[model samples]
Target: VGSAAVVFQAARLESVPDRVSTLPEVEIQLFRDAVVQVQEEMKEIKERMADVLPAEERALFDAYVMMLESETLIDATIQRIRDGNWAPGALRHTIEENARVFEQMEDPYLRERASDIRDLGERILARLQSSEQRRTGWPQRTILVGEEISATQLAEVPREALAGVVSATGTGSSHVAILARAMGIPTVMGVTDLPVERMEGREVIVDGYQGRIYLQPSERVREEYLRLYEEEQALSASLREHAAEPAVTPDGHAVPVLVNGGLIADLKPSYVEGADGVGLYRTEIPFMIRDRFPAEEEQYQLYRQVLEAFAPRPVTLRTLDVGGDKPLPYFRFEEDNPFLGWRGIRITLDHPEIFLTQIRAMLRASEGLDNLHILLPMVSSLNEVEESCRLIEQAWQELCDEGRRLVYPQVGVMIEVPAAVYLVPALARRVDFLSVGTNDLVQYLLAVDRNNAHVADLYDSFHPAVLQALAQIADGAHHAGKPVSICGELAAVPEAAILLLGLGFDSLSVSVAALPRLKQVIRGFPLERSRALASEVMQSESSAEIRDRLRQALIEQGLGGLIRAGLH
Candidate 1:
């Protein structure tokens, strides 16, 4: 639903042509200093990659570092300069000649290496050009339309001026999407047949959420987009104002509103945005972004940081939930139906050492505090939970054997798979808590992969079956004297948040951006009214009907502002 009006500008990413046209008297020291600066920049880039990109993919940056630090390249450039050639010209000529030689190689691998070298040379040239006081004059509020964007250019986007990004190619998991999300910029990737070349300087509307852009939109469309953007900004400001307020219902019920995915860099902001605690600190990110499985000490430091960041505020860490759509490069295996394939606790159960290392780290990270809770993802069988708990027991004993004092954290299961709903009653007994992952549950129950554009429409979390399962899981956990929470993409929707609160979930975890609006929506209703809304929704059979009824119900309950604000 997020949309913006933006001006399109192709990045100034051209490499130095073989025939050098402009001649500037640049000092040799400037060349030397720029190389060192780029080396440090590349090193910083690698360190930053640890937080986001997996270590394997970070070879791109490592290559740039090697190219900059290469004695062969550096010595050749210096020798050419000593022969009295212009520094920039000499450097470009030397790099380009090498790239030419590499490009002529019979090996495809060597040819690809040639392309990488040319790219690195272009980047170094761009930096040197900037150092020479040549500036890129970017227009205001750029959509940054491009066929492709490098990770380096992606990182250096003037975030303050970025309206959004439109790429002709890239998927949701692409680095472009990752960086754009981190910068909170709206971005549309994988757009095909977009006549961007002809549409330059035309007022365009980019809908990142919908992956569509309108060139020279009609007045009606222009007004609509402007309204949407205004409401979004106003709503964000309004939400931030109430960031410190408790999420209490009108009837004085306290429903803890937690934050999902407190990756190391995002913790402080989540807290500032009024997250009560971390309901789901996804641990898969560490595994997903690294080339190799992070060692015990590395995992221990991250878990400890999370605990310390929100001390006294509980953090629930979900074990590695990979193997489905998130196949590790290290663990390559074929699967006909990956969503139902080896994933979550299933993968960990088969690989005991992987499971043990993580469990032991979480246990040790808990050290003196009891705030850390471990959640088992995609649990379908009671054995997954039991075996994981047994490992937890053994981990605690090993810690004791080492003479380190530690408090054991609570173990919980995420009811995501369809089989998990029926097993909740059994799962409740063996676990300390339950969390309903509506995103996966809805997809699995409906047999619809939401990522599939053709079937995305059918993947409704508002399905009657989804509502019923949510209620069952919550009640099952409550009946067993354990608290339950809803930590999924669905919880971030304001209407869905209200409906979930009505479903008797003790807590709801959503993105930090949705906190203020969601809290505002939840506080608008009395617990009794939400229950009535949930009950009415549960009575309906059609997903569309349920959605309509909920919207009407929210409006009747005097929370229609969210409707106008485009909370959907």
Candidate 2:
């Protein structure tokens, strides 16, 4: 929770009139100089961001560099400008045309990349105008408000002066939200109804924990929130005190709490503390950041960094789980229902060259560490698993032939598809473990696109059907003498973590921001109590009932603060 004066950022480029204009030789030279200046500025930002942001985030600036260095963009803009077109207008048109292609795409991640293009265009436009275009009059405590907050905009603010952030359109997974979480700043996103024009200079409270904002709250409400804010601070301090503590139940049931990370920032002392190991090390980030496929050596180095950082602690590296929301720019495909098609294992299996290269790199990275665990995403049938195993074996044998001593890593399948849930026993027989990707499982099971705001309300991890699937997955994995774990958004919630523990998940892999709170819940709540709660939750007829049961359980345990205020 945080309160500050709202500063609504205006869309300056949009306000500028668009027109084609004849440019003199000097004007053309000015535009050329502007391009060079923007390129230098982008390089400086990229260098500065390398130290402050995670490797994955710093890669975002690479797109800007690519745009600035692109012969197509520069040549086209210069031609248009020399042909009696405004430089800013030409650049804006080119950017919009490119962005429109992505904007028309179904994937939210690609759609969000459109914003990055627009942001870069704005930066170049400001440079062309010979203006810094930097906002300077920030309040001591400023809550940056905007229709859509950009990573560059957030980075421009003085971290000390910035208190919170509110965007009218964005999800929790958006780039701005990721940066906010990294900076420990409170942020509320996807506030579609926020009156951005009226928010400026207003005193607002941002309840980021609950994804809420209170504009000009009453005295009583203000006082109550102030109290909540203090409690939240205390909770954070208390969580830190137990950072190194194990997430074992009071009744002696141990639950390993791991983090789901893919960036270099996850290797930081702050993020690594109190975690068991990486539950889901997304291998897609490195691939997504580059213009071309990463070389086997590049992949090996990146994977090795994560392996070495968490040496001896099992790091489950999921092989390229791209498609759906994440699409590689260099490699593109079209699908009617991309989520249900050409994604995850399907994509890799079709392109054995890609699969083999990645597997070899992973094997090489784990040559000595032996903590690497390979996970297959979106496995539906037994044949898929068999084929994947065959490929893995091929990579291992090839590496061994090269005289490199290697230990075969344990393999697992992500139970995201509904078919995988029923095939758990067969899968367990082949793989070493099972992991429930609750986010996608819920999406596929309920036939609701969680990214679609119109139908997002129907997506609930606590639904009776979802809970039943979790139970079945756990039971099937256990029957085959294999462990099952959840590495999704559901695993991060304290109340949900209790349910997962009760439902027989062996471990909970969550984001770094959620690790401490989950550890606290696991350490405080007894396993027996969690199991009992799970039993009661299974009997619930609806998601609402299940949520209420979870919330009441936390309140009864004197851990109500862990519950979001919106739930209350």
Instruction: Give the best candidate by TM-score.
Output: 2
* Alpha-carbon local distance difference test for all models: 0.74, 0.81
lDDT of 2 by residue, 336-421 (tens): 88888899999999999999999999999998899999999999999999999999999999989999999889999999999999
Distance (Å) between predicted and true CA of 145, model 2?
5.9
Clashes of 2: 0
lDDT for model 2: 0.81
lDDT of 1 by residue, 1-568 (tens): 2222222222122322122223323446667777887788888989988989988889888888878888767778766666665455567667777888988989998888887776666656656665753324444776666555444445344656667777665644343454465455676766777554444445667776566777778889888888888987887788778877988899999889887763565676545448788888878777765678999999999999888777788989999888765667677789988887888888898999999999889988988877988999988888888998999899889998999887778889999888888888889989889998876788888887644544645767788888888888888888889899988878866678778888888998876656677788777778888888888888888989988887887788777767555643
Candidate 2, poorest ten consecutive residues by summed lDDT: 1-10
**lDDT, candidate 2, at 308:** 91
